[model samples]
Target chain A: MSCEKQSPPELPGCQEANGPLDFQLRILSDPRLLAVVRCTVAEFAAVSGFKEDQCRSITLAVDEALSNIIRHAYNNRRDQEIEMRLHADIGCLEFTFVDRGEPLDRSKYCAQPLDAVALGGRGTHLIRQIMDEVVYERVSEGNRLRLKKYLPPARLTP
Target chain B: MTHLLDDKRDATPMKISTRELNGTTIVDVTGEIDMSTSPGFRTALLESLKKTPRLAVNLTNVRYVDSSGIASLVEVLKAARISDKRLVLFGLNEPVQEVLQLTRLTKIFEIRKTEKEALEV
Candidate 1:
């Protein structure tokens, strides 16, 4: 067996000029990285003025995304990094993960409906069902997944 | 910016917040959510479920979350299913998404593209 390192490219979605909030991290594809990203998310949300329940959901979603890269993408090998971005508008949030390696099975990700006791195939399925918008862009270099969540727009004028 | 707070040793650089949208509870978390902190994440989500049937989680602010966090989520998702409540996860950062995809548990919960769609579910 051989270990190879593939440097990640500059991810596209993070540079949004008008997004209300955003976070970007050059993360090593490690289980520990999930915790690191978790901390980042918590801090970001706190500063962004998200409520506690909103914080919990955001943390959970972030955990699932980063863990997938460490455990699957690099197969827990110490060779690659998962570039990450988290963004929040006034009433919405966005999470994007970019992989520098090969592309994933697009059709295989059917966005399965929720069912208890089902074993696998729930990763992309869940992401698709939960986020308000889910978009996948397959670039020449790698794959980029963008997830968005919107709360009801605040009624400040009222 | 936080360095000043660290120097003063008087300010907590991170915090947590939650809100109810329609029938769903939305948590926009921001902090270092690991083993110790993940419990807070789990508790907050679970606690809200006791009061509401719909739950939407926005992961746009969370910077870091650990395996314990994942475990906590699995529990939350399981409980939500058992109670017949609708819970959806939205706005997953890259690191979070990778973890879910690898564990093959991403199939277990509803992760939508945006909060708008999640609430509609």
Candidate 2:
């Protein structure tokens, strides 16, 4: 929590020449902050060498994850706190979200049938579709959601 | 800059404006469409559908859209189908288009590249 602290200990190996190319953002569960967070994620993804389209997809996946945390985990309460950490390298980008809210049900982890034109449970579906790996764990205090998007090695165009 | 976001951080979260062109209802959506703003989008869509069967959504300015947002649009499409109406979309930026493609909803919706083409449909 100290302002002088640069990066968390968990992200040691992910540092770069300019220092750790990682960011940790902590905010209340306010919907207004969504845009700022999305912008930050997009910029971070761009810095990690993702293409513009890939950055956008990463942003949307993170947005949906945060929205689910705010709505389902906190039950639309804006007073709760949510923490997001971004770690990236040449091969992949990982996002970890921690929230002091309700635990997610294991039964709801699966994507629902898309045949019906219903509005429920599509957030997780999109998250699964956009990200290569999605992991959810319930902690003693709340929950943790980790999403990873794989980036293939850059290819040379002859 | 944060100010760009500040400009869009209004009391009304998402801006959904509508106009008519050549008998087609065009809904112009600006700002992020997520869980918080999808309700307003639903209202705008339902209101637009009440007036006409055909709805054309212009999403050029939408910076972000999550699954809930997509669901709202799907709800609109479902209602349109049941009511024997038509729904066409144009001006979808890359992110929106990618989401639709990933969900396989692109094949389900009538998408065009231009408003003129959408109106002609």
Candidate 3:
């Protein structure tokens, strides 16, 4: 079976946490999904310990990674459903994108940014610089890319 | 993965506000930049280049940029290289700076961290 045809391992936080303190988002590859995901992150920020900068990192990373899939993985073809899941938990958040398509060229991508300023190649680069940790995997039917970013360790205050 | 945002407007997110400072037209951009929006960005920046030898772009309000944003900037760079005019970036946000660093583009163009610095360079 293609990796996409298989289900993802149950995510770490989504299956464990509950409350106004947490969030989980799952949406198909539609570009409009950014709104719902951002709103969820906003909610996590408002009620939990995260600040805006931390949230924006996740948002932008997700945006870039997904944009890459939209542009290259699926090649701007809308027929594929880009699935994303965000889990905000204890000290950080984890975001995942799953799509059943061809594997990407790892060599073609570097988290490092370049200034040749070509129009089409910026997507993968953006995802690496902004997010704390990025991992790419190929499961049975599809490709999985996950990003994780940590909030500052909680401060000890008076 | 399908990362396309489903905003109804389909209008480009980048906005243009131009000011003539020291005889150069400085175009300030504010908003999210992407494929849907970068073409407009390219259009606006290129238009500014036509009328002046010096163009300063203030990117302070630009919240996010993607390949398209870089492309638009590159477009300006190409124009500057060919025209022998100067195009500079001012008020680069962290995300923008991060993009430049990864691309190693800082060496190619004059970048100022603030509007004042950009104007001076």
Winning candidate number (lDDT): 2
By TM-score, the candidates rank as 2, 3, 1
Q: For model 2, which pairs clash?
A: none
lDDT of 2 by residue, B2-118 (tens): 222334365655798899998899999987787778889888998999899689999877766778788888999888998999998899987788788766688888999988999
Model 1 ranges off by over 4 Å: A1-19, A110-113, A155-158, B1-121
Greater TM-score among 1 and 3 belongs to 3
TM-score on alpha carbons, each prediction: 0.48, 0.84, 0.71
Task: Point out where model 2 deviates above 4 Å.
Answer: A1-20, A155-158, B1-13
Residues A88-124 of candidate 2: C-alpha lDDT, one tens digit per residue: 7546789999999888876876556754566677777
Query: Could you arrange the candidates by lDDT from highest to lowest?
Result: 2, 3, 1
A16: Cα error in model 1, Å:
16
Give the distance in Å from residue A91's predicted Cα in candidate 1 to where it truly belongs. Answer: 2.9
* Winning model by TM-score: 2
Model 1: fraction of the reference interface contacts it also forms: 0.02
